[model samples]
Target chain A: MNELALKELLYKIADDQLILGHRNSEWTGFGPLLEEDIAFSSMAQDKVGQSYAIYQMLNQLGEQEPDTVAFMRNANQFHNCQLVELPNGEYDFSLIRHFLYDTAEITRFDFLANSSYEPLAQLARKIKGELKYHTLHANTWIKKLGNATEESIGRLQGSLNKALPYALGIFEPSPLEQEIIASGFFAGEEVLKKQWMEKVELLLSQTQLNLPDWKTIQPVLGGRVGQHTEHLQPLLDEMSEVFRIDPSAEW
Target chain B: MKFSKAEIFTLLEDVKDPEIPVLSLVDLGVITKVDIDGEAVHVEMTPTFVGCPALDFMKNEVLEKLKENGITQASVSISFKEPWSSDKISEKGKAALKQFGLAPPMPAHLFTDIEVMEHVPCPRCEGTDTELKNPFGPTLCRSIHYCHTCKEAFEQFKPVS
Candidate 1:
């Protein structure tokens, strides 16, 4: 791929991480419990750190400065998944969202860890280590909520029902998907989706919750293509407020 | 192509934990083995905690630092055997912790008998009167405690895994 195309791909990854990190940060100090609050915040910090690395790479590649790419972009220009754009509704909903995202991300990072692109491969290796902790955190909650009181199980099931469609949106392909796959930057989307489903299914089997039938669920579009839900605008507004004030200011 | 072992040990010491920046794995007492065979250097490390985020960062930093110091073929092997513990911290590391405002680990022998004593003496205040608040602190490695004498809340690093 050309430099422009590569830069766009990098931005897509960075933007996804930035938006998700921002969304997750909203839960700081407000999580269901103290341990969870710290865990969520830690995960949010990791996402922001990952975004920083990608943004730095983009700047080095001469595409645009990190601030310009992160804060100056329009909502429609962001390439994060639609699921990450959705606001954290309830604790159960947030857990559901986390479970789905972490499962997919684990598979994604595993493939990226071996990318032919040296920098990406290195970042992926670092990210994969952190991602393992995230997966464990999500899995702990899933199992706890799944086996807890009937009320907790009911609430968790409701969250899964509501969020699963949007969770599927995370797999939406970019235009450079073929090149990325061919270059060994990532495994094929189909394979990734399958792996994600299998992992999710395995976890679900341990709980009382049932996996939603794939055929019945309609996939939400956008996110990967820069289209976003209504919730993204306010999030972008808050995140970019500082950068928008003085674009030239050193962060 | 011959190099002294002491030179390579210094290179390994230069690579600090990325998250904790101030503590090298050696200082943290997480480095389990360092072997030099011909031109290749191999370093083994155990995590301070089972799921530390700094593991990969430390590994990469070790490789880069070794290469920069003219050891081109350095290998980092992670081991879980002989898991790291606070007792493994060198005397110098304990002094560094006290200097850095973190409470150093109490002598391992003290922990067994002081099960009921909720507060250890504040390393800063030298006061035996203190209270334990939250077991979890800002980071997984710390626990929140308050010093009654100094009227300050501080994070104390927990025992290493």
Candidate 2:
């Protein structure tokens, strides 16, 4: 059990959930429909809550408290894939991003449920069930709108094309990837990416969406290594604004 | 005053869920364990949903109830040691939820598909001709549904395996 490998793995997972959870929350009042609004907000709560739980695991391993870690981090410190931090452009883009990202997320956690790390395995077991609804929501809309109108199909296709490269970034190999895998902490990102591709392909096949040649797209990497887009800092600033004002204030 | 583990559980029966007041924490199946060590009581609980906002309130309520019963040296800890599933909700809790106008979840073992959410029996009319409007609801642990028979919307405490 390499502690550093475990922490690195935990940090990336937690950061991904936290950032995307914040993005999902942006749809709270702005969903195209009332149910969609509540749906995104609910998933946001689930994701953020899941991140907090993982952060607690890190804390048990000697990391800072969850609030301080979440609020105090600069954009460069975040390990979330750039795909998640990208602005939710339109209903089509947001929905497509949700579809692409959650496909990988559910698969990742499913593998993680069997992690050699017991604490992580237990947490992943719990999280795996909650993610079902997130995937269900994403799949439902992708099928419905993906087959609905010409405009709907075109818009989704455009977003899908735009998001795939960044979505591929989700599996950017950790520096300790082999150690993490050999230690049984995880099965590694390569295995996860293969399964993710399969799942994504299956879902899109059920719709009118097109997936281009996988080999042609160069994955926009580095998010797992603390590299992120310009959008992240502003989002972090806004997210931690209230906390920075009074770090010790009880909410 | 030393209480036995069973006795501690009995005392916890009075601690109701803050959101669903009709349901006790014991009945809701969140009280995973209660141990008595000397004069101190240790209660281990798990949340129905990890992100449930009512978790802290429920934990405090359990502690407050123990103190109100004169057990001052008590502690409560939250964990996933015994992760909660919808199946853990006792029959009594299910009845209480129905009476409180919320449908209880079906057994998680019964279905692996999201379609299981469809056609749930309406808590109001006990009619199976219901529709799953949305899988997400007002709370993390619930889902919104509509009863065609009753012509009204309701929420179900969703099943999570």
Candidate 3:
């Protein structure tokens, strides 16, 4: 790949993580319970940390400094899916989103673990390890909410139904999808989407929740290609405000 | 190769954990790889956990250690693949944990075993009659437990995810 393409690819990956991390962090102190609060916050931190690593890789590739790459990107340039950018609705909604995203992330990281790109492969391996715990945390809550009061189950089901279409946005392939897959930098997007669906179906079955009709929902858009909801601009502003104030200042 | 394996290993030994200054991060098994090319040394490491608060400090520690060891052209790179796990704790680090009065973690897979439910011996009292109060303690890594015999509360490292 040419330098510009590689840099763009790295930005897409890094920006996705950064946006999702900011969204998740918004739940730090507001989760329904204390243990969950800590767990979600921890996951948010991991997302940011992962983004930081990707940014460092971008720097090494001689694209731009980590701060500029993260802070300077306009909303449309971000590649995260609409699923992650949506507001944390209710706790159940957040959990539903977490369920879908974590499962997909685990599958993606598993493929990346074996990526032909040595650095990404190594990074994926590391992220995949942490993801095991994330899956556990998300699964625990899903089961709890699924088995709780009728109200809880109803809420979860509603959230799951509402979120499923947007969750599909995560699978939207970037323009470089072919090159990335052909170069073995990542697995084919369709295969990954299939695996993700299988996993989601299995998990839903375990929870006795109905699988949303994937065929009927209009797929949500804007994440993979950098189009995002209004939620992102403010999030980016808050996240980068301090860094932008003094780019030369040591963090 | 510019540097011998033994010399490279010794230089890594100087990479200490910023949180716990007494122990080298390598001894903690956080340093995963060391590559040498002539006079250049490249070190690859991961944090003790994802989003560890001490990551920046640890990164600087690696660079400082290599520089202090006379490696002028050394580079320390960070990775997140195969994220750090307590399972990677070196035997030497395990011993150090024991000496610090923190019980080494029981493997998560073996957590359901009755043997693991048995009280961990208190480091202060050397008594096994302890009761777990809760799974979370002072840190994400520990659980709060108390020894009946010693009448003292102690923290035990929980087998964390």
Question: Model 1 over residues A95-122: C-alpha lDDT tens digits?
Answer: 9999998888878878877777777776
Candidate 3 lDDT by residue in tens digits, B6-104: 767677777666544545677777788888887888888877655577877887877877777688888877665545667777777667776777777
CAPRI-wise, candidate 3 is: acceptable
Candidate 1 yields a Cα-based lDDT of: 0.76
Q: Considering just chain B, what TM-score does every model have?
A: 0.87, 0.96, 0.80
User: Which segments of model 2 are wrong by more than 4 Å?
Assistant: none
Candidate 1 deviant stretches above 4 angstroms: A1-5, B1-137, B140-161
- lDDT, candidate 2, A1-251, per-residue tens: 69999999999999999999999999999999999999999999999999999999999999999999999999999999999999999999999999999999999999998999998998888888888889988998999999999999999999999999999999999999999999999999999999999999999999998999999999999899889999999999999999999999888
How does each model score on TM-score? Answer: 0.69, 0.98, 0.83
Residue B113 error, candidate 2, Å: 2.8
Q: Tens digit of lDDT per residue, candidate 1, span B64-136?
A: 8888878887899766445566788878777777777778766544443223235866879868788865444
Give lDDT per model, in order: 0.76, 0.92, 0.74
- Arranged by lDDT with the best first, the candidates are 2, 1, 3
Tens-place lDDT per residue, model 3, A1-251, is 54554555566666767777787788877877766676667778778878888888888887678778788777787777888878888888988998898898889889987877788787777676566666766776788778888898999999998999898888887787777777777786688889999988877787857786789878787687778889887877887888888878876
Q: Clashing residue pairs, candidate 2? A: none
Q: Model 2 residue A12 lDDT?
A: 96
Q: Cα lDDT for residue A98, model 3? A: 88
Best by DockQ: 2
What's the C-alpha lDDT at position A83 in model 3?
Answer: 85
